[model samples]
Target: MGSAFPRLHVITDARPGRDALGVVTAAVSAAIGYQTPDALAVQVRVEDDVTDRAAYEFGLAVARICRPAGVMFLVNDRLDVAVAVDADGAHVGADDLPVPAARAVLGPAAVLGATCREPVSARAAVAAGATYLGVGPAFRTSTKAGLPEPLGAAGVAAVAEAVGSAPVIAIGGVSVDEVGELRARGAYGVAVVGALAVAADPEATTTALLKALA
Candidate 1:
């Protein structure tokens, strides 16, 4: 799964006119049809208010959607759900489980992702067994609240440099237009939420995002 990181990662979210699972299906279907499933990973993330049962069901559905296509399916901040659903792994933020704890829960083979905004945290995350880093709020975003200031492209570059071999995935307010800039700045890839969730045509939007990365 070395090539699995540094690819397009779609994080699920619900907003007006957007069915999170629907958008995920469309985006993933498009990626599979375009022969880029290997370049896609979907993280099952719902609002904090959602019940664990609901998140677990959603994770199962996403796993079913991704498994056949060989796309990695991950649960956000839910190690139990990830394990129960047999997902590829789990993604954790600063407020969620600590890196080593998450690694412990998921064990050595699971793909553990950690969020990092600066060099020190990036190093700590890597040392704690994070397979990859989600470095962001690359630009201001509404998808997540109380995020620190946006880390622009240069900020992303700095974190990427600090992380060395570990993949740095830029997140928060990332759009198709910003993918190239992020990649050029040494970001392995991006984790998107609002951009595709609210898109009028998510399939086409996914296609455009992949093209940009290409």
Candidate 2:
């Protein structure tokens, strides 16, 4: 899982007239075609209103799509669903299970991602067994409401430096254009949502992102 960190992380979201699974599948398919399957990972994150059963079903479908391709599939904030679907891991935020509790549930073999906005929390999360830290909004984001201010490159670097070897995934409103700066600032990788979801050409966008990461 540590080796899997710092790769491109594509988070899925269901939007009007758009198929979340379709977008994720397309992006992952394109990514694997462009690079090694390990070069990309997908996190299945639907609306909060969607039921646990629905989430589990979605996770299963995504896992099926990703596993065969060698891409890691994770469920956002749903440990139960992740386990039920045999997902590679789970991503938990501040309001979700504490890092220790999450690690306890997923065990050492599974990947556990914790969200952090600053250095102190970053260190704490790593201490609690978080495999990686999602630190952001690296830029202004409209995907999630009530997010704190963006943690520009310097903020991301501070957290990365604080956590030492733990990978820092710059999340929130990330774009392909910011990849170089983030890599230069010590960010291990990025987690993107709206960028690929709304892109006119998702496969092309996925290729561009992978190229930047390369």
The lDDT leader among the candidates is 1
Off by over 4 Å in 1: 1-3, 15-17
Put down candidate 1 lDDT per residue, 96-185, tens digits, no spaces. Answer: 989999999999998999989899999999998999999999999988888899999999999999989898989999999899899999
All candidates: TM-score: 0.95, 0.96
User: What clash count does candidate 1 reach?
Assistant: 0
TM-score of model number 1:
0.95
TM-score of 2: 0.96
Candidate 2 residue pairs in clash (backbone atoms < 3 Å): none
lDDT of 1 at 109: 90
C-alpha lDDT of residue 119 in model 2: 91
